[model samples]
Target: MAADRLSALPDDLLQHILSFAPEREAAASAVLSRRWRTLWRRESALDLDIRPYMAADEGQDLRNSPSPLDALLSDAVAALAAFPRRGGGTVLKRLTLFLDLNDVDSSYDSVDDPEPVDDGRVAGLLADPAAAGLEEVLIGCEHGRMRTTTYGLPLASMACAATLRVLELESCNFEPPLSPRRAFPCLTELRLRHCFFKEGCLQAMVDAAPALTSLSLDRVSQQPPDSAFQAMPAYCWVPFRLRCLTATTLELKTYSVGAEEEDLARIGIELDMPSLRYFRYTGDAIKLSLASPAPGLSSVDLNASLRGEQSQWEPTSRMLVSFSSTRALKLHVNCMNDIIYGEEEHGGAILPTFPNLKLLELDEFFEYTSSSAALAMARLLRSCPVMSELRLNLNMTRWYRDDEPKTNDPARSPFAQSMDRFNRLASMTASSRRVSELPAVLTDDGAFTCLQTSLRKVTLQFNANELDCFQVQLAKFLVENAMVLEEMHVDDGNTFWLDHLCNKLERWRADSFRRRNLTDTARFRVHHLE
Candidate 1:
């Protein structure tokens, strides 16, 4: 009956059913019968995938085939054109094209310099009125070593559709003749990755999109570097209406530390927009200052991974990022070896205080001394008086190690000395007066009480054999202190130990009055060996 009912459905319903299949599979459905033959052609949505159709034999014989790239493009164009029209009208609503160009091998020495494929066949298909309603376009091509420069996209011939909103280009060249203005008028979201353009081409592209809300540029090259170009001015462009901006791998060979500091200061002084909210930059270390102190910004992520001997780690400028309206903050620094030498050399410490902060994640934070790091952490916690969630991924690699040799006697090993130092450091943290100043949720003792009273969930992840005395002490503290804890999610490397831990808890409940009190006041749900 279901099959009978499906057979009675209209072409639109049948086409929608077939749309779930891969593009090639969906096209194959047209061979079922005359009625289905024309149904795929009239379909409004088109997903043109050319990867599966590529043949290893054909690729191997590329040298003998006349214009391999052009031939492929022509076949794609013909396939789209051959689709049956609905009421003699084109039915293309959205189109996605993926191209994987193979590398030209040096062994094919017989082939002379090949002509670049100016394949206008696919471009011509996009210009048809029936396909004019395309709302999204994605073009991606694989990179090869061939230095075979293909012509830019024929975006100028594309008819602007009112419904179009997104345009993405990946590893493709956009030559002259087709400017951004003539390409996309109603576009709102644009992403460019590993694209090459002229000096002002990017700025012009952004200027043309009046309604653009999001922009991302990664590894975009303007011009090749020159030996004489050692220092360049720091670049800054403000999109008054942009709400999100992300830039990665942006390289400037001639920028000075002083110039970067000044540019950040200028940005802080010049731009003031209520709509701007999210900003992310990952490149060489650069100073960042907020214009009007981003009172409305919600989040900020900055990561710099610079290499080479000349790479400097100190934050040269004071970046007072004021996030009066921010609720979430994430700070990540990879290497801090260069910044630990002198207080005067280090840029002003980040003193961000979020009164209403709810979530904070700090990763790879390091300092030479535990006291300084602890004090800084205390200040940060104090700033977030109402903070509910905090995560610290600290690497204390250098703090506890003493430079002096521990023993002149051959009997004592370095391993034993290292263990002694580790115990001493653990004791210091346990007895430190500074621990009293942290938030009630983070204090060693307070952390246990909070787990018992306010904590609704607990997650413990550790390797059983790898668990040291520090981990044991922390685990015991948590179990003894959590008064209102409801559930615990644990991942112990050994299943036997996991089961033993659960059984011990159950037995303690069966024997101890304290356990009885816990059972009455809280629910202990254990998920072990996960």
Candidate 2:
């Protein structure tokens, strides 16, 4: 520039601009000149990513070794201490600390072999007086097989709780106080993932964080209730028993739900968040009692191992009734028995119509490929009177219907051995063809009538199983009835086949008329078979 515009600004403005840079870059700016050397030190936030420690030690097969994180911790503490205070007060507000034990995205080890944190880095950070002004702390510790059990939770109210507004803890043991009466007075968002807690500890934390508006617990392990606590009542040990919380959004996933095979103690749930708007759960089929219906709840996701037993399926019935006002419903079921459809004993109960539901998703976990499966899928679609979009994910080498979209990642590539064989054997001169069971979904003109459907866009992914009656009929029905249909995607699962199934589609169909009309549709794209 003609007059050095950046240097023309005041010192305060220069320091503010440097604060936006990464911590390392902020420090490096000092090498530019004497003017920038001291500007980086005035930043209010300390975002530290301590990953190089473990990255350097990778493939060494080190176990139970002293944590390399200790040095980084000391550096953070020193930085916090060094940040100058005006009028004898701290200015630190945000501290995002990510302590990764191993490289999850590019890990060579099959097992999660994490090095233990033997240093006093974490404790020093929490206890430091300079952190009194910290309002947000996103601290995560991921060890392959280690947790900070000895330290428990460094969350005493006296330490930064009064000033903390957002707290996220991962892989940390949470021990509850006798009665959490005055804790996290200003906290609003709390997330605990892969954390260990005693029976009463979770409830105690919820009771303390009265101002919480959002809460998420992923893979949270709740220990068996103590003998003294077990005798109290069933609700005492419940994982998500939030009687006092008025949070509007909640996501909870349990690690242990006692079934036949596991030796884990039985876990119960009782949710009473009247203001909850979004609810997501992933766990075994342990029954949960809803204290009241979330009138404002618009989205729900239920991932469970629903079996033939009534106990597991019964809760789903209650959830359907409770989430009647929900606009979107997603079900990720492990076991797809008739019981999951509320067929046996719970079918008689009149389930409310999902009047607001317009989008439905079936998880890839469902492997049922039959007429009954179609009916089961239609049952949900029928309940949602105005459903516009439906996404299906087929997990078992075909027909994938799910609540969430699968990303384009090599790790998630669906390249199976069967696909390889199908590719090599498949050609314009077909050798062997196997037909799949035809599902008479539309034959019964009662519950599911595609002619009167409100579907606008449909995306289906399935393994090309002979492209038989079921697949053809389903495709034809969608092209005809979906008057408002915008786009249709038919994906074939043959990721890395020596010979592609798509290349042999013309030969396999045989009938020229069928082949010509089959691909013809409104905004249709048969995804290339990889």
Candidate 3:
């Protein structure tokens, strides 16, 4: 440069500029000049990923002691210690570590290897002097073998607690904190996935983060109920009960519904976040108790494993009452059907009206199967008077002929029954194709207010090679009834046969415009797989 102006900039400003570059590029800048020789060492962020250093060829072995990645990790930790402190701490403000601890050591060669992989080397990185100034931290481990041997999070010794604002930990075991006081006073967002907690440890950890605004816990479970303690009824099992006064967004997902019924029944979720706006729950539909009404709640996404049982129906109705104030909702097809059928089973409790609902998405939907399901769908549409958008994922695999026998065997496993029904449907797909008659409830011209007034956009997704007969009927009904419809999007999952599907849609769109006496005003588009 003519005046060497770049080197004249302050150290802090230069470090802040280098923070946006990749770690390797930032480190390589040291050779540019004398002023930049030690500048990269004090950059405010570090993101170290071990996957690139992993040697896939047979010549390089990862199991050897002091492997290349292991040595690099050690060197990085040592380098962090050498950074001079400014304002009582180093300038590092963000740190991320992506680790694969599955085959890190040669000792883990056999299934019954007595030696456990040492996690202290990874934990030591956080103990560095640079971590005291960290504002955001993310540590994620590989999912497969790492699930069995999880990294124990050493929160008690972490120096970033006072300054951290965001923390995300995946595939780690939580160690109970040494104190009950707040550990992350300023943390606003916390996400824990595939983590295990003992009885009281989860609540303690949540209570420590008093300022959290967004929280997510996926597949976080306590120890399974002991089989030998048959007489105890699993009372020692602590339900996930919390009363976060500050959180506005929450997502909770559980393991699959293979656990024993008693264990499932004992796993209750109780939340008292009065300020909550968005909530999503995906798992077996267990007991949900909301202690306070959330008047500000805007969106809800509930994906529950449902069955034809009275116990499941009543609880679901109570859940609907809790979400009466939401403006947007997403549900599975069974959930939509069960809303009416479930309330009928529970002594015809008056269904709550979604006065503010605008958008609704129904996944795994089968169009107009049985009269009860049709009636349920009609009632649901009638409730959302102001709904503007509707999305349906047409599940063609569940379609069957009218002459097939219905199977409701309780003793047989659900998976086996599903596979059997799928095989039957596959065999009859080509031969038993017939156009289905529209349900009388849906055909009623004035039954659905949303369709007549507010419904504007409709989206349909078909994953099967051939569209079901009822799917076509449903499309025609929407085009005829939705008076204010703006656009219809058809997303077909069959890649090779997209042209065939598009041709069908084109003919239908032309026919729809003629039926409505409108000339090319509606927008109909087909989305093909890339």
Q: For residues 157-251, what per-residue lDDT tens digits would candidate 1 score against the true structure?
A: 66643456776766444444364445455767776655555345555565555566666665444431232332332122211112223221111
Winning candidate number (TM-score): 3
lDDT of 3 by residue, 239-341 (tens): 5677788899999887654334435454567789998999998876666768998989999998766554546323554556778789998876353455564
Q: Using TM-score as the measure, what is the rank order of every candidate, best first?
A: 3, 2, 1
Which candidate has the highest lDDT of all? Answer: 3
Better of 2 and 3 by lDDT: 3
Indicate whether candidate 1 or candidate 3 has the larger TM-score. 3
Better of 2 and 3 by TM-score: 3
TM match of model 2 to true structure: 0.71
Model 3, global lDDT: 0.67
The superposed Cα distance between candidate 2 and the true structure at residue 192, in angstroms, equals 1.0
Q: Indicate whether candidate 1 or candidate 2 has the larger lDDT.
A: 2
lDDT rank order:
3, 2, 1
Candidate 3: worst 10 consecutive residues by lDDT?
107-116
lDDT of 2 by residue, 1-530 (tens): 38778878897788677755657767898897898876777666677767765566566655654455654666787777686643233377778777764432332232122222334447568768888778888877756543323224545623677888898877665546644554888989988876666666777777787798899988765554555444332222234455644898888886544343232223356788888888888876555556887778878887766545544434454446667788787877653333245655555533457878777776643343545455555556557777777766544423343322333335654554555445545642433344332355544445543324566666666653333434444554555444455555556554324334344433333342254564423343344423
What TM-score against the true fold does each predicted structure earn? Answer: 0.61, 0.71, 0.73
